[model samples]
Target: MDSQLHIFFFPYMAHSHMMPAIEMAKLFASRGCKASIVSTPANAPHIHKAIESGTNLGLEIGVLSIRFPTQEVGLPEGCENANSLTSLEMMNKFFTAVNMLDQPLEQLLMEHRPSCLVADLFFPWATDVSAKFGIPRLVFHGFSFFALCALASLLRHEPHKQVSSDSEPFVIPNLPDEIKITRNQLPDYMKEETEFSGFLKKLDESELNSYGIIVNSYYELEPAYADHYRNVLGMKAWHVGPTFLCNEEKEGYKAVRGQEASISEQECSNWLDSKKSNSVIYVCFGSLANFVDSQLMEIAMGLEASGKQFIWVVKKGKHEEGVKEEWLPEGFEKRMEGKGLIVRGWAPQLLILQHQAVGAFVTHCGWNSTLESVCAGVPMVTWPVSAEQFYNEKLVTQVLGIGVGVGAKKWARLTGDSVNREAIEKAVNLIMEGKEAEEMRSRSKALGVMASRAVQEGGSSYEDLTALIEDLRLQRHCCGSK
Candidate 1:
């Protein structure tokens, strides 16, 4: 194995995607492989921090900056990531800007001629670019094997299409787990034909043609789905994940953008120290999730009614002005002053979750957050919003038995019926005080221990990563000999 083997990573502009990819790059660097991450200028700052941490450990990880075509795509300056966008129409423009990078990305690949290129699944054309240089392209889906299997099964069977109404629940066929999902719970693109559907179809085709797929999940978490993906899908794949946990000892390894904890470590610790062990609930949606006023009010009321100590993250949004005055119940903050803490921008999620005071999580079921919860040994009250999240909910509650859903049957918007205070209260109570909560807590702790062990020396995820690096080194030697 040559120390000169270079692996380049290209993550999508979103925080959820970029965070894991950056961690993957760091892991490669720690193993003495020359690693680099490609990003737009706006995203470069976040990557720089991670690279700097690796450098301190005597690992060489570089950041390659490509200009994001903001003006060309009609996006405002600094509107690079998905969280900056305001509307669905703006998302198309963001993709347009991302696709414009193809030319620049190709030029970089030609110049560097890295041993392998790891790219996000959204870029279907990356396979062609890698082929031009004869480099292997590993598509990083940034999700678990279970969600991937469920989505693939849904697309193949089209079970949602067979249902008459959006509320009708149907069992997904040909899966290792018996999972039930309603039509409305499906991604919007699957519900009706949209532009995203076309993009997803193309992405799926490119995945089959690419070198192999890399997932941010471990074998112990979902062995059945991982095996199904290999035997049934016939795809070359590797499961080296809970990537964030790989570099726990490295200081300054925080999430890019909105994931950083707003409260100081000392301050957060002081607050958590006041609560009893496993007595507090932590609530946060991912960076991109935005809720309507009605929904926000319901969540606030529900948390209040649960009569538990909690920490909730409320992100800033266009329609979020005057939320305290208009959306919340009268004197809500005053009433719950000592009982809860509301973080406005970013919450130190990893630190908070690892604290002994934290008991459960109310999450949107995003892959990164879900994995973090699993690693921290916290039970979850699932409330999936969009984009394969409902599938993830099934994995958490039905398969793993570490969570319970909030009875959100559909992806709600400002116009839809809010999940209501009653449902949120019930879910919170179930995870906090009910008899089932104890079983969930025990299972969560067991999974957490396995997750930690999997990333250590001689563990499943550790071996998979070692195999991946060695495979690349062998490929480089074989190619150079020619």
Candidate 2:
């Protein structure tokens, strides 16, 4: 009773992973626990800016850094983060650099010896590293319960193999819902055996050996999958999110949650104010996704054909192979001058989605983006590109009924999906108007309200976080050293 509990949060070097981990750390810090975020030198600066408010309030929180082996691993200087990669071929060396952090991270643990380490799934060795110091390691998967459960079921039952073709949809057995997925939609780890797939195996093993999981989700968001993951899969877990709701709504707070805005929030707001409620569509893939000029053209033409007001978030691709395909048709901007706003970089996504004039979203179905759309009461046209996004698309289109799929059939980070403008236009039109669209909007709004309440005092997320912190404290008392 004479001491404070200190918790260390170590997130993967990605925006989605670090942002939520920072929020969760602040949540713990706000509730009277000493929290510190662990990152490599490059990633540590992001934490500094985000935790300023918490530190200013005299909350027990700060940042810690680990040395990344850049030269030894053949990666460029300051290339510790995943977003720094210009091409997929560079992943091998980047991953090797990440793997080399094991020793430095362990050295830090020996020095600080925090009560618990809430580590991201990227570090499969985190479990063993924390165990060396008798510290509890909580795995932050940063995904929805439904997506996790669906993956678990797929792993348990190789239903994808039962189908003859990669595109054939097969029902994953024993899930809470009758979820159907194709082999092509699965992550490379799930599709077939490879070096990365073996790494994924290690990640799964590490998670199993860890103390428990801390998800960025709430019970109301996917109650069935929550129960299924706990009761059926039997993993020790706790849900303490929609964690972004922890921050008090201040001016431009939402705009800069994940990253700095390329365009001013006021400028985006003025554009939104010009349109009526439920009229505009916002489209964005997350930071790590891109497409060839052909796919980009399809999207541009689709938005043009939808004949609706829209805001599209895009990034300048680092012209690989010295061939920069034209992403837009001739005079496309002139045609969309008033009807659309093309934000050619990191736009304030949460800001745009939560606005009254924004009705539907066209998203790549990243967990952060999907959950943000859920919180904003906006339905989606799901176009999952890579990672677990395809599975998330299933959850949205099938189980949740809050989104429609754009018939994206492949899974790749930098993509050229055969999903042409017609498919894009059809899905956009379906989710933007008519009785079905209204019903989807109503369901989304109800879920958004539930998400809000879940983070309030005495709500499910509130209590879960309270319990999680207390549980960590008790575990430290039993197992940790001073």
The lDDT values for all models are: 0.85, 0.86
As a whole number from 0 to 100, the lDDT of residue 405 in candidate 2 is: 94
Model 1, residue 370: what's the lDDT? 96
Error of 1 at 38 (Å): 0.3
What's the TM-score of every candidate structure? 0.95, 0.96
Off by over 4 Å in 2: 53-56, 317-325, 480-482
lDDT string, candidate 1, 303-347, tens digits: 998998999988754335554445567888889887898887788
Q: What does the lDDT read for residue 377 in candidate 2?
A: 94
lDDT of 1: 0.85
What is candidate 2's CA lDDT for residue 150?
80
Q: How does candidate 2 score on lDDT?
A: 0.86
